[model samples]
Target: MKSLSVKLFCLLLVVLLTTPAVAEIVVEPEDITWTTDAGIVTFQIRFHNPDPTAWADEVSCTLYAQDFGVFLPNQNEIGTYDVPPIPPDSFFDVFMEIPFDQLPPPPEVHHPWDPMKVQPYCTPDDHWDGNVDLIWAGPGGAGTIDSHLGTLLVCPTYGASEIHVVTNCVINMTYTITGVCAGFTVQLVNEDYTAAPSPLAANWSGYIRVTADATVPIGTVCCFTVNFTCGGSTIPLILCAEACDCGPISNEDLDWGRVKSLYK
Candidate 1:
């Protein structure tokens, strides 16, 4: 199962470059990573109005990558957003996102693999830079000025996220798909009891494994979730794995409770 946090991400592409002659466009929190790993990356775009007596209204903004370089994908637009009204001498905030799956890889890799996903896993130092523009028509007036879009740090990466079963001594443990798990597969592994024989051992150990098919783009993080029921009530087992792989429940993320107590 995927983390509940990943399922909640929403938002993606397009760029609009409008200059403000009198009014100005300002963006905050620069140098953001491509973040396709986290699904969608949303950043704030703030519009600035210099005039003290007038207001900046009807604001529109756009942001995108300028280039991903050789061997990687080249996308012009990343995402666009509309800015709210900015009072004179103040700033108004809006948002733009890093689109996923919308990116097209280079032609050489255009089969079932290339262009399969938006993540550009070409060079380890892939820096996707681009232009940004936020325009607004106000009583003061709008003008033009070329500005830098938020830097898209598309660092080339490889690896798969996996979920492992570390629990032991659970009889007939099973799982059910409780959410939409499109474009992925899950595996159930049963571990035989070594201390005791098969028929004699009532409870054993096992885990559900998830691996990314080669078709899955490199550095691409899959999305999905599942519920494991081990019959009756019991304490959640500890899970652990490499970065991005899911398995053991982290101490910070799990809520512990006493399922039962042993007495003399």
Candidate 2:
């Protein structure tokens, strides 16, 4: 029996070693924060493909605060996206935005800090005690999972120094628009973009809405995406639609900050 067990173990090891590593989707969560309650909270997340071959998978997320582990509207979950297949040994980025309407308002806590620089948003403190889960989905389907543990971050700026109330610099970050669904186009727009130099800082931030011809059932969702690159990182912003009356969905007001250039 012991010999049989050893043989089975060796067989499983050999099978795993010989197969492509695309079964698991790994996510490295970056600590992010927001100041206002008017818009959605965006999470800067890094996703890696550990597979030896290219892979595309279905991804979704849920958010809960530390002090308040609350349920979101319309079934307590956020958006769902099918990421385009990534090459072997490569990774990409995505900005997961959970709408303010679907989430609990940030607790009115007075204190906020990070290990890096203690800066502004000092009054904004919330926690991502929930998780992002990825399951590998290929041409048909595969069997495996990649799950990031609870992201417990309470209102850390990740070391932001200056407060950008107005706009100045326009060409700092690179933009890439990836089409998750059809018939919808997205653009980057900054109302105050100029050639003149200004000040301070802020990274990728935006909102997106989808429009399509197909009718999805009520309680179902469809999503689209647009991504940008800044400081050698590719971040995809995925926006979704919730079916209210089981009809074709429409677009919402998408406002983006102006940038210098856009690439594939």
Instruction: Please list all clashing residue pairs in model 2, or write none if there are none.
Output: 21-51, 22-51, 190-258
Cα TM-score of candidate 1: 0.30
Best prediction by TM-score = 2
**lDDT comparing candidate 2 with the true structure:** 0.35
Q: lDDT (CA) for every model shown?
A: 0.34, 0.35
TM-score of each: 0.30, 0.30
> For residues 111-195, could you state the per-residue lDDT of candidate 2 as single tens digits?
1122122222122223332323333344424432221211111221111111111111233654444644343333333323222
Clashes of each: 12, 3
Candidate 2's displacement at residue 232, Å, is: 39
Over 1-264, each residue of candidate 1 has an lDDT whose tens digit, in order, gives 355545443211111223333444443333222333344545455556666755566545455443221111224565655566667688765556655344432111011111212223232212222333333333434532223221111112222222222323336544443332333454444443122222222343333344443344434433333333445632222111111212233443222321110100
